[model samples]
Target: MSPVCLIARDEWRALLRNRAGLLASGLLVLLVLVASFTSLERRAAIEADRERYQASVDEQFDQQPDRHPHRMVHYGQFVFRPIAPLAFFDTGVDSYTGNTIFLEGHRQNSANFAEARQSSLLMRFGQLTPAFVLQTLAPLLLIFLGFASISRERERGTLRLMAAQGVAARQVMLGKLLAHGVIALIIGLPAFLVLSGFAATGAAGWATVLPMIAGYAAWLLLWAVLSVVVSGLFHRSRDALAILIGVWMVGVILLPRVLPVMAEQRTQLDTNIETEIALHRKLADIGDSHDPEDPYFNDFREQVLDEYGVESIEDLPVQYAGLVSIEGERLTTGIYADSAARSSARENAQNALVHDFSIISPLIAIRQLSMTLAGSDLASHYDFLQQTEAFRYNFVQRLNRMQAELIPGIGGEDPRISAEYWQEIPRFHYQAPSPFSRPSDLIWPAAVLLGWLVALSALAAWASNRLERNLR
Candidate 1:
């Protein structure tokens, strides 16, 4: 056997004999398996509930008796975000960002009833999903198992003895990396298999899932190399362990929390109340329908008359009031959409800052990559909102069109429309955001992760060379 392979085999045997290593690995495996099954079940339950609610809402809308078309517009509709197939693995921002949105004419309702808002403070710390396990805890586990790999040999004088036996420095370091790399792969295999099974059965996209698996594999391998190199750098096992723990604490635990706060502070965003007040002011400036002297409405009235070849709005073919309602809705919808666009831009700008700093914490980069692939990120949620908004516009306008075309011609006291027309109006259909479109979103983050690995490999080489000379 090659000397490097021989040393690697020996290291693997040592790990098997180490009780702490064996026990930790076992527990983590169990945790991941449990997480996998339970996450899927939870995901399924949420999906079923959303589907049920949507069906019920649609039914209620369809069953409405003869009523004024404007009244039906006020009846509104509900839209629920569809969970991506791989959401069980990542969950991402789903828990905090409400999955359901109330969509109505003249108003953009907030998404409400999020899980985190209902849960106790303990839930704020973290979730127990597979992504959480791998992102937050698995690196710590690797640190515990491999932190002492080279340092222990040095502390016990075995490293000097190996050099005296004519063992090469590069071979010794390669053996440590190989041993820990195998362990990292072993540690990640169960979760990968679970995800792969999801992909194979068509629960998730194969292209996205394959890349997800590769990202995680690279993440684990990066940690393993760091652990082995840190061990090589330190002469004392305890010293190496301390440094590794510190790195884990800062990189995995501290920075993720801190950086977002920093980003938010840097990019100021308006509160919901402030945004609503601003919207109201903008609408007020656009002219009130009730005020006959309002210049904006006067101009709109002229346009309507000219369009229908009539001298007065009252003499037009359609009900002037219903025509006015349609024009009013168009103006309001435009202003509301503008506010929404600005709000979305601000929120995304804040997130952009955080993503830019992903290099400082590779964990954040992996998280962005993970969430993007899973289709459970903020971007996906935003896409849901956009789709829902567009649907709401079309739906309300259809009822307004009904009022303008059908109700004016009937000339009844109630000014009602046939209930059958309700069924003709479209229901909300959420178009799942395509992961394929945002390959650029993953590129920078993945590059940051790869950069970490390459930089650490060079440091590992330098440490190995220095260790070789010191022993000689």
Candidate 2:
């Protein structure tokens, strides 16, 4: 066997002899399995419940008794965002961002019933998903296994003995990296297998699942290189362990938590109440439709009259009030669109700030890549909101059109449209944006992870050179 292979085999045998380390590895694998099965079950239950509720609500909307078309506008529709198949592997921000939206006329309601709002503070720590296991816990396990890789050899004088026996320092470093990198890949195997299962079932595509596996594999390999390099730099195994633990704590845990707060402070997003107040103020700037003498409505009325070749509102074939409702809806929808854009921009800016600092903390990078691939990121939620808004506009306009054309000739104060018209209204069906819809979102985070691996490789080279000099 080659020197590197021999060294790696010895290291593996040592790991097997250490009962505590062996047990820890077994437990981590078990945790991945438990998290995988439970997450799949949980995702299935939530999806089934949402599907049932959606069908029930859609049925109820169709069965409504005969009523004024305008009355149906107020009744509204509820649309639930369907969970993506890969979301079972990584819930991402789905737990915090609500998945259902209530669509009504003249008002844009925010998504509600998020678990974060209802659950305790402990929820912020994160759920036990496959992504969580690979991203957070897997690195710590690599540190434990490899922190003593080279330092223990130096402490016992085996490194010098190897040098005298013609073992090159580069060979030792490569051997250590080979052993730990293979172990890192092994640690991540369960998660990758889970993802492959999702792809095989047609819940997720191999195109997306392949890249997700690559990003996470890069993440684990980065930690493995860091652990072995740090071990080589220190003269004592305890010193290596202390330094690795501190680095893990800061990069994996502290930076992720702190950077979000910093991002929020730097780019302030409007609160719900503040956004509502701004929307109302903007609406006020446009004259009310209820006022007959209001300049905005008067101008709108004249336009409608001109289009139909009628000089007066009453001379028009369509019901004047229904026309007014349609015009009012158009004006309000413009304001809502502006508000939604501003809100989306602010939230994206906050995320961008966090992403910019991903170099120092790779957790953020992997997280962005993982969530984006899984279709459970902030962008996905925003896409859902936009889809709902478009649906709302189309449905409301259909009702307004019905009111204008069908109600004018009817003579009663409470003129009613046929109940059959309600049955014809289409139900909202959301189509999730493709994961690659924005190429930059996927590219940047994946680049960050690969960059970490490159830098660590350079560091490993430097550590190996230093070890050679020390032995001389």
Candidate 3:
């Protein structure tokens, strides 16, 4: 075998001989498996519960008794965002972003009943999913296993012995890299297996699963290479361990926590109360239909009259009040859409600001990749909200059209539309945003991860050269 291969073999043997390192690795693998099973069960339960709730709400909407179309508008409908199959691996922002929305006419409601609000305090720490394990805990494990990869050799003088035996510095570095890189792959094997199983079962598409696996693989390998490279930089194993731990703390723990706060402060988002108040103000600015002399409504009435080629509201073939309701819905919906877009923009800006720091903390990059691939990110939630709004507008408009066209010649204060019309309103069928719908969302983070790996590999080469000089 080649010298590099022999050195790698010896390194693996050394790791095997270290009982504590072996035990730690064993426990992490076990933890990953447990996390996988637990996450799968939890996801299934959530999916079932949401499905049941959606069915119940749909049935109730269909079962409403004969009533005025306007009355039905206020009754509203509930739409629950379906959980994505890969959400089992990384819950992401789903726990915080509520899945269900109450959609009604002339108004847009915020999603309510988030898991975070209902769960215990322990949830604040984070979920125990495969992504969490691989992203956060896995790096720490790599540090523990390889922090002394070269520093220990220096401390014990084996590095010099190897040098005297004619082993090249590049060979030694390559051997360490090979050993730890393989170990990194081994560490991620359980998660990869679970992902493959999900794909085999047709739970997630291969397109998404493959990229997710690649991003994480790079993430683990980056840490392993970083550990080996840093280890070579120090003369003492303790110093190398300390440095690696600090890097892990900053990149994995500290920055992930701090950057979000910084991002939030950097770009302030409007609060719910503030948004509602603004919406109400905008609605009020558009004069109420109830006011007989309101100019906006007067002009709207004239438009309806001209459209129907009638002289006044009373002569129109359809209920004039229904026409007003339709117009009101259109106006309000337009305003609400504008508000939603602004809010989405602000959120995207905040997230972009945070993502910009991914260069400093590759954890951000992997996290972005994981959540986007799983379809549990903020963008996915926003897509759900947008689709629900569209459904709401269509459902409400159908009822408005029903009241205008079917109500008997208009004069009754409480005109009723046939109950059969309720069935005509469509149910909300959410088309989950394609995981690859926006390439930039995946590409940037992925590039960051791959870039980190490449940069670390370059650092390893430089460190190898330094090690050789020290030995000479």
- How do all models score by TM-score? 0.98, 0.98, 0.98
Q: lDDT for each of the candidates?
A: 0.88, 0.91, 0.90
Model 1: residues >4 Å from true position, as ranges? 289-295
Worst 10 residues of 2 by lDDT: 287-296
RMSD of 3: 1.3
- All candidates: CA RMSD in angstroms? 1.3, 1.2, 1.3
What is the alpha-carbon lDDT for the whole of candidate 2? 0.91
lDDT tens readout by residue for model 1, 251-345: 99888999889988988889978998999999888886434446788888888888899997668888776776777788888998888888889
Tens digit per residue, CA lDDT, model 2, 216-295: 99999999999999999999999999999999999999999998899899989889799888998988888775455677
User: Model 2 misses residue 415 by how many Å?
Assistant: 0.4
Model 3, residue pairs in steric clash: none
Instruction: State, as a TM-score between 0 and 1, how close model 2 is to the true structure.
Output: 0.98
Clashes of 2: 0
What lDDT tens digits, residue by residue, belong to model 3 across residues 1-472?
9999998999999999999999999999999999999999998898899999999988888889879887888899988888888999999999999988998888889899999999889986898999999999999999999999998888899999999999988899999999999999999999999999999999888998999899899999999999999999899999999999999999999998998899889889999899989998999999775454577888788878888899977687887777787888898899999999999898899899999999999999999999999999998998888888988999989888887888855447776766777887778898998878889989999899888988988998999999999999
- What candidate 2 gets wrong by more than 4 Å, as runs, is 290-295
Positional deviation of 76 in candidate 2, in angstroms? 0.1
Better of 1 and 3 by lDDT: 3
